[model samples]
Target: MFGPRHPLMLIAVLLIAAAPAPHRPRRIVSLNLCADHFLIPLADRGQIAALTRFARDPEISAEAARAAHYPVSRGTAEELLALRPDLVITSPWRRAAIAELLRGRGVAIADVPDAQDYAGIRANIATVAALVGHPDRGTALIARMDAQLDALGPARGHGRTAAYWQRRGFLTGAGTLVDDLLRRAGLANLATRLGRPALSRLSLEELVANPPDFLFAEAGPVRDQGTELLTHPAVLRAVPPRRRLHIPGALIACATPAYPRAVANIAAQLLAADRIPTRARSQ
Candidate 1:
């Protein structure tokens, strides 16, 4: 029972007025391809202001088709400022300088690291979902992902060794998202077996000299000299086409909503490749 002019009531009014206003970002910008993965799936389409230039590239982004509807940012501080984004998602690994500049300007930003495994993917999804003010969406996404993984059942590889061979003689190794994917499929990575680093090159001769039980390469035509090496005569002789598993480049580029697709594709392709004639699969 206090009067309106009571000092205690006056203090309460002042406190309420001084409290920061609650806000949910309506204009979001993604500064890296990795951020684009989360922003596209979790945020409302209208909430998106701009995405990275690579967002619509099917060669690397699984959400390329959906991303086409959104505008893209050049990633420069000026361009980002012009968009007047309320929340900017960035990968400090890719554009640290730009993030720093934006921070100095008092812009709200969130740093999303590149996910390296299933756990990392879950963490990133949760981070983006909460940032977009949809924590429930994040939970739903993770639940869907868990269900998809559970449907994959146990690993079927039977400890067979497989190499994720790429253009330019590059080999994906352990301590990476691909390595975790390989493990989930019950296949041992050739790079892990050979004690190779996360990323290393092997000459055609070296690859043939100690080839894995299966070679996994990107599907599509030979578009350049680098890709041409994947179809060289020696490579074909070392590992026949039947033993060469092909996966789309988009599926394995990152651990986003597309990750479950990548897992299913690999599992399906490996099962099919396993049915090849023994003679044809032999080195």
Candidate 2:
């Protein structure tokens, strides 16, 4: 091995070792569900001052189980200020007023982008990891996610199509995270055929007239008109109960490093759906 030729080169190395690491925020708070996903994996527990109240909501937050171990916030600016966090992370599209107010008070606020695809997802992970002073962890997490996604294979549904049917018949459209997940599972989104926008309402009559090969809906009941829509005689007659897949919103609803789990879950459902004999299923 070759050594530093000059004594000054060795002196430079010594100075670098003696230098202190850059400052990292100690009290971190996640103001939203998606923000909790980033902070949970990237920060030390001691560093996490608080998380959003929804962190424990199994219906939405992906890290609900993990979030249970940390202190949860009430989502009010007053409660967040009580935590005395150096940083508050939330979605830019949501709570803009809170974000601005917090900034006015000299708190550093970072917004998690609503990542629609793998590239956006990767950028989001890297962004949060760097904020938490563990950029390397982000890199490793992405690599793991990529490997899992690769093993999951692509959307292999052939001509089979599906839709992420939500409350009030709100369909998640193309270019959204849910659509990307459906594609990764080898399923085409029915939203495309309907010419729906990023998010649009579809009447029961319309849905019944042009049903998809499958429907991706939440496992829990909404106890509202959405429930009525799901159980509607026309909808049942068209798609039937067997074609409905109950993928929880937590597995989706936001961009997280655990995205591969969503993709794998959907892919498994499609594979299982294929097993039903069409002749028998029609009746």
TM-score of each: 0.86, 0.87
> In angstroms, how far off is 161's CA in candidate 1?
0.7
Clashes of 1: 0
For model 2, state the Cα shift of residue 122 in Å.
1.3
CA lDDT of 44 in candidate 1? 90
Best by lDDT: 1
What is the lDDT of every predicted structure here? 0.85, 0.81
Clashing pairs in 1: none
Candidate 2 residue runs with Cα over 4 Å from true position: 1-22, 93-96, 99-106, 220-222
Candidate 1, 16: how far from true, in Å? 20
Could you give candidate 2's per-residue lDDT for residues 1-283 as a string of tens digits? Answer: 3466678877889999998774578998887688788888878789899888898888888898998899997878688778888888877775578666677667788888788887888899999888887787888888888888878665657767898887778888998988887777767789988788879988888888888988876566548876667777787788877788867688777878768888788777777877879875664
Q: What is the C-alpha RMSD, rounded to one decimal, of candidate 2? A: 3.0
Every model: Cα RMSD to truth? 6.5, 3.0
